[model samples]
Target: MFDLFKEKLADAEQTVAFGSRLSGACESPVCIYLHGDLGAGKTTLTRGFIQGLGHKGNVKSPTYTLVEPYELADWQVYHFDLYRLGDPEELEFMGIRDYFSDTSHCLVEWPERGEGVLPPPDIDLTLSYAGEQRVIELQANTEAGLRVLNKL
Candidate 1:
């Protein structure tokens, strides 16, 4: 049982705004799987999401670091980029379980790379290039995800 939403973004700014909109609906612990090709605006959306949640600094992709943690006033947000991950087991060695806690919100890019090691995502967001623009699709895989979608 899932719900889906699709929106067309005219530019990078629209993508960022859409991500900020999503941030408002995520108030609890939730995992979001972000799917996209290189330069598909995954990081852009993440930046908006982090900033929307009260982050004052930059929100760069954790391509080299694997994960970037942002401790907001009321939430612990983690942005993960698994594109450079050599093996899914590497996540285990890094104590991946510690990142997904009751008070944490995780947004994972390239989640397929960590298929076996990562926790299931409540929501799956796919970004695709549409000529000079982009299209984003959101799928809710859990009740929490459904609630988030409903709010949008």
Candidate 2:
């Protein structure tokens, strides 16, 4: 079953807090796609998620590097930014399949850029500017995603 959730974030802090809440709900290996325009707080939310998962350091966008690996105590998280991609086939050269292992959690930004090369995301999250604030909408496309949604 598919499920969806929507909320308005008053500021960047709220966006981060929301991501932390989402981290608490995620228990198994899952893929999440983040959609937003530049400065829409996608990386801010990811920072909260990485920190929420117990990382104590920085959470920088992988814009230039393409992907950043975070080895947390219990979860292997990979944050990917495909915005700079010129070809989806480049994902093959990088062994994209290995990142989706049963024990890893993957968060992808600009997923459309990697289209056919990437795995289908369990959760699709979209953020948009709303006046001075922001709006977020999350959709669960699989059972795993639905489980997370139910927990949230």
- Give the clash count for each candidate: 0, 0
lDDT of each: 0.94, 0.94
TM-scores of all predicted structures: 0.98, 0.98
Clashes of 1: 0
lDDT by residue for model 2 (39-75), tens: 9999999998888999999999999999999999999
Worst 10-residue lDDT window for candidate 1 reads 21-30
Local error of candidate 1 at residue 125 (angstroms): 0.3
Query: What ranges in model 1 sit over 4 Å off?
Result: none
Q: Which pairs clash in model 1? A: none
